[model samples]
Structures are given as C-alpha cells and as structure tokens.
Target chain A: MYLRGYVSSREFFEYNPPQKIQNLAIRDYCSSNKFNYLLSATEYSMKNSYLILDEFLKFRDGSDGLAFYSIFQLPLNFTLRQNIFDKILKKRKQLHFSLENLALKNKNDINLIHNLFFIKQSYQKCLSLTDIKQNLKL
Target chain B: MLNSTVLSKNFLSDGYLKIRPKNQKYLFEIQKIITNKISKTKLSKKNQISFLNNFHKFQNPSNLNDTRLKIYNYINSKSIFSKMYYEIVKEYLDILVGNELVMQNKINLSIQLPNDKSSILPMHSDTWSGDSPFEIVVWIPLVNCFKTKSMFILNPKESKHFYINYKKNSKKHDSKSLFNLYKSKFKWIDIKFGEVLIFNQCLPHGNVENITSETRWSLNCRFKSLFSPYGTKKIGEFFKPINIKPASVIGFNYNDPLAE
Candidate 1:
C-alpha cells in the first residue's frame, strides 16, 4: 500500500519535535509496515492553517492512505477533527499514526482516537489547575 | 595531587568521577531538608542515615512515585536548594566542564525502593533522548549505593565499541537484550552519601531493580559549558545560565554598529 506521510511544522501546544526526527520516524514506520512511503507533505507552521491537509485530502487518490507523525498533530478543534475523520471514512481510506503504531480501521478506532484526545485535554487542564493553585499560593 | 590534567584524563578515560565534594556542609544541609520532607516525624541527626537507607519501610512501591514527585517539586522550587547543590560541586565542575556553565532548570530526584521493578531505569544513554552530548550529569546519593542499589555505566572503551556497532546491534536487540549482551562490560558505581559522581551522559548508563535490602535515593542534575552546543532542549526552556563571566555578560549585550 502507498502511504503519504504527514509532518507538521506547527507547534503542538508548547512542543514541536524537530521535523527531521518526525520524518525519520515516519520513514521507519513505513519500512516496518511494508508501505511504499511517498514524499511527505509538510504542514504550514502558521496557526490554524490546514491548507496542505486540504490539498492532500483533495488529491489523496494517488495514495492508498495517509500516515501522521503523531495523533496530537490532528486538529484540536472537535468539529474540524471530525470532518477529517468523516472524509477519510467515507472514502474508505486508512489513516496511520506512526508514533502510536495505530491505524484507523473502523468506527471503533475513531472512538479510541477521540478518547485519547479527551485524555490529553484533561491532562492539560489538570496541569493548568495545579499552576493556578501554585499562583494563588503566591 | 589532583591537577586539571589528571582530572580531565581520568574523566575522559573512565567516563565518570566519584569523589568527595570540597565541603560536606551543603550536602548535610540538602540531606537534612530531604529527611524532613520524607519523615513523618522529626528524626535526630544520629538516626537519619539509617532512616534514609530503610526508606522502603516508610514508602511502598505503589505510592513511591507520588512521594518522589512531591519531594522533587518541593526541592526544585527553592532557590537555596539549587544554589547549595551547585556550591558543593563548584570546584570539580570548574576543572571538569568550564567556569562558565549552564545548569538544567529542574534537578531530578530518583527514589528506588528495594525489590521494586516499577522504578528501574533500563540501560540507555541520555543523548538517545534530547540531552546534549556536551552535558555531564552530577549524581549525588543520599545513602550508600553498592551492587544493585546503585547505577551501572558502560566503560568508555566498551561504550565506543557499542556505538561503533550501534546500527547492527540495535537492529538485533532491544535495550534490555543489549544490556544483557554487554552486562560484563558495565561497572556498578559504589558511592557514599558525601561523595558525588559526575559522569558522561553520552555513555550508556542506568539502574536495575534494587535487589538490595535498602532503598536507593539519589539526585541528578546536568551541566554544560555556556558556549557549548545545545541539543533539542534549548537554553531558555531547558537550561539556565548558572555561572557567567563579566566578558560574556558584555558580549551578550554588545550590539555591532556595522550591522544594518
């Protein structure tokens, strides 16, 4: 199967792993899974820009599926994320997350991905709450 | 006589140094602070050593991480703690690394309970993550560490060999299997409370499960020369300028008039 790797230049929250490292991981993922790794589409560094992602979706027929560096690289906005999922599912294309070694195969996979996002959001909230409490102490 | 030449040669050859700090005052102070935090009731100076050694009796494996984090957060919050930490090893670092240094922002505390598999650090190099190769880790134990109670570091010569054949070996084995293959090449560190261990972070080093009867308590912090190259962890976010000379201070603020 042909897989187009997606590498994000934009920071996810406070961290952005080096782009070279992300691509290396994607390359390793492709080689291990026996996917013909095509050239990756680098996402724009600008906040809220998904122009490349939109282009990839429009012209995704060239590739069998898309591979992301990580699950967190997906759109944080719930509706935007859902739309991407819907489009991929409707087209019956596979989505691979290299860092997590997971693939979106069915509706259950979408639910699992949603739960992970929820967990991440809650973890961030808890950290912020702790920060606020510490600030109040001062 | 421990001259700079001798010190540098020994450090480079062995990839580590286990020596007593210039003074024990700051070490005693740091130990006292941790003892107060971990102990339910105040302990006298005489019983503190035994209490630390037998810390597993007080903290179980399940709640050990929470306790360790709480203590870590508390210590790192205090400016005095970092100041004292650096003061103890100032002379050694001045000789080994450089006079102008940048220290890691947060000092890490490791608490390994006896027979606890949960807290084991599998064999790996810090450089495998984002740590700079220029950095050196200053590890201070709160109790006597020997055998499985302490950490093991691969000999520098063996480390070079491992890295030379890294691609071939890594393809064949995971970290655990790799450690097993080269287990005999690693030297287990034997350090006491007042002594400090400064080791090359590029060398493969980590601790196994503490099979000894006592628990293990140690603190580790990284330092690199101010002008040295940085890895993924950049200066402002991960490191702070701890020691800077007057010339460097002026250089930082100096703006060239020739530039447009």
Candidate 2:
C-alpha cells in the first residue's frame, strides 16, 4: 500500500500534525552499536544539514567530545565555526568502532548512554540506512 | 591588523575588543529578528539562578523529534543581516587566526547568571592545555551590557595567575567557590547593542547575576586556524585554501578602496 493517507489519519497519529520530533537514528546507533559520529561525516557531507544535526544530537545527552563539536559547529560566524571544528576533529578516535563504543570526553572519561530501540534489531542483525533515516526523523 | 578602527589597542590590552563600523544600522534589524524568535521560544523559570541578574535563551528541546527549528532558528537567515555578519566575521577571523580559516562550524546562545544556583561553570579559562592557537570567540550582544547584568572577563595576562590563585584561594577559603575569592580583583566591560566583542578563550571569563528585567542575548561563535588542535569530537571539514577580499564582497558598507 502507498500509505499516503496513513500519515494524516487521526487513528494512526493520536497527537496531530506539527508534532515535536527528534532524529532518533543517532541515539539508536550509539546505543546498540559502536558507530562513530566523526567518521560518518568525513565520508559523507549531507546536502541537507538536518541529517547531520539529527545524528550529532545523540551526543548531546552528555559527552565532552560531543559538546565540543556542538560548540564548534555553532554558526556565530564561519571562521569561528571552522576554528572550533578544527579543535574537535584533531581528537577523532583512530579506531573504526561501532557507534556503541563511542564515549564522551570531559575531564573524566564518561560512558556514553543511549537507550533507544532503533529499527534494525527486530528486522535484521544490523541497521539499515533506510531505518536509520526514518529514526532520525528525516 | 588591517583596519585601523577595527579594534582599539585598549580593547586588546584589556583582553576584550568591541567593533563598531561607520554603518551600524544592521543592529536594529537583527534586534527585530532576535526579538521575534525570542517571543516564540519557551521561557525558562523566572528565577532560574539566584546569582543571575537576568538571562534568556531559546531552548532546543532534546525531545523534539524534528530539529529543523534548531537549524533555521539561528541568526543566519539569508537576509542582509546574515550576509553582513558573514563578511565582518570572516575578515576579523582571518586577522585573528591567520588567513587559513573555516566559514562556520557551530554557534551558541547564552544568558549567564554568575552566582546563581542554576549556574554550572566552575571558574575556568576558555583555553585549556591542548587547545588550538587560532581558536577565538566573537560575542555580539543583542542588548546593551553593563556592570549590572554583564559577565566578567579577567585579562589574559592575569588569567593564568588568577586560575592559580583561584585554586589556592579555593583551598584556603574552605570552599571551591572561585567567585568569592577574587570578587574585587576582576575588571569588567560594559557594551551597547551596536558593538561586537572578540576575545581569546585564554582569558578567564564568566557571568553571574542578570538582575535586570531585560533578557540578555548573546550570539557567540568560535574560530580556529587551519592546523589548530581539536579535541576528539571530529568536526567534518577545515581550512579551505585562503582568500582575503573586500568587506563589501560579504556585504558590508565600506570606504572606497580606490579613494585611499
């Protein structure tokens, strides 16, 4: 089925249109696997800034490294953005690990927390890009 | 270094600089944009922090499933104001961090209340041990900032000493409250809306009580040199070649280049 009418149906969405949303893919990725926020962007620069933000926010729950990147990405002006980003990337994890293994970087080493149940678990052993996009609310 | 009136030496020595161009009409326009956005945002508790004289910021709710509001909600609308900011910041950053600079990576919104219980920052400098040299801050206030609700910035020369004295003072005073230690040793700067202040993160700074009724809004961003040291978060791209051009290219009014 096309599922076109399902989105607007009151039965389907008890809330309503204009509902507040979150990009859940990042949270799920971080929670269930050891995916790196740093590597994905270097490999792919999204024409859509929303996708990048949706993925990055999973770190905001609390991670020193993630906060730094958040500060760096601020668009006060381009140069400041670049400079902050420069500092953030100088510290990417060298190992290619799943999103689950990534950690926060404050004065103390923190265990990153992600309690999202992303779509990949029930359907397949690993996450699908399609499922990731849907969860990110993209 | 390039523009004579770009920043006064007094500002540099004081560890703070404010920039005001011949044409400052952009202030009123940006004020309208920010004000409208502020009205639409969720207001925080009336008494968020005791030490804060006053404060306000648009909260990007963590629970929001769609973050488009977070993205477009910034001051970077494609209007003339954004273009002007893009020009001014780009040039000044080149001067401060050298020619090799990146356009933008991140920005911040803050209304700091120094001694308020809601406040969380300990006395610390923007600069930590392994930071990149080019990293600096550009803070433009949406409202006039004065001694009352303003934040504190210790001179860079005195910051390191201040930090040491703070640590020592914290131990001697029987409390970790740095605010109590150097209450009188600090210098403060008062700013009006039509000004932009740039400071090196190495300088120690913090804001306490925002007792005023007016909500203090500041747009802040950090810039870095091409090869600056970034800690491990991994910002995607950096330093696109190098281009230093006329301010007008970014859409700033200027004295004629040919006239000089």
| Highest lDDT scorer | 1
lDDT of model 2 at position B116 = 33
Q: After superposition, how far is residue B12 of candidate 1 from its true place, in Å?
A: 0.6
Give the Å error, residue A107, model 1: 56
Per residue, candidate 1 scores C-alpha lDDT tens digits across B1-260 of: 45889888999999999989877988888888999987888887667789999888877678888899889978987879989999998889999999988787789999888899998899999999988788999999988899999999998999999999999999999988999998999999999989999999999999999999998989999998776656676454466667667785455444559953
Task: Name every residue pair that clashes in candidate 1.
Answer: none
> What C-alpha RMSD separates each model from the true structure?
16.1, 18.8
Candidate 1 — which residues are off by over 4 angstroms?
A: A1-138
True contacts kept of each: 0.00, 0.00
lDDT of 1 at B2: 54
Q: For candidate 2, give the lDDT of residue B228.
A: 40
Q: Give the Cα RMSD of candidate 1.
A: 16.1
The residue-level lDDT of candidate 1 at B22 comes to: 75
What docking tier does model 2 reach? incorrect
List candidate 2 stretches off by more than 4 Å.
A1-25, A28-138, B1-12, B22-25, B38-83, B112-122, B129-133, B163-176, B232-234, B237-260
Task: Quote the positional error of residue A13 for candidate 1 in Å.
Answer: 15
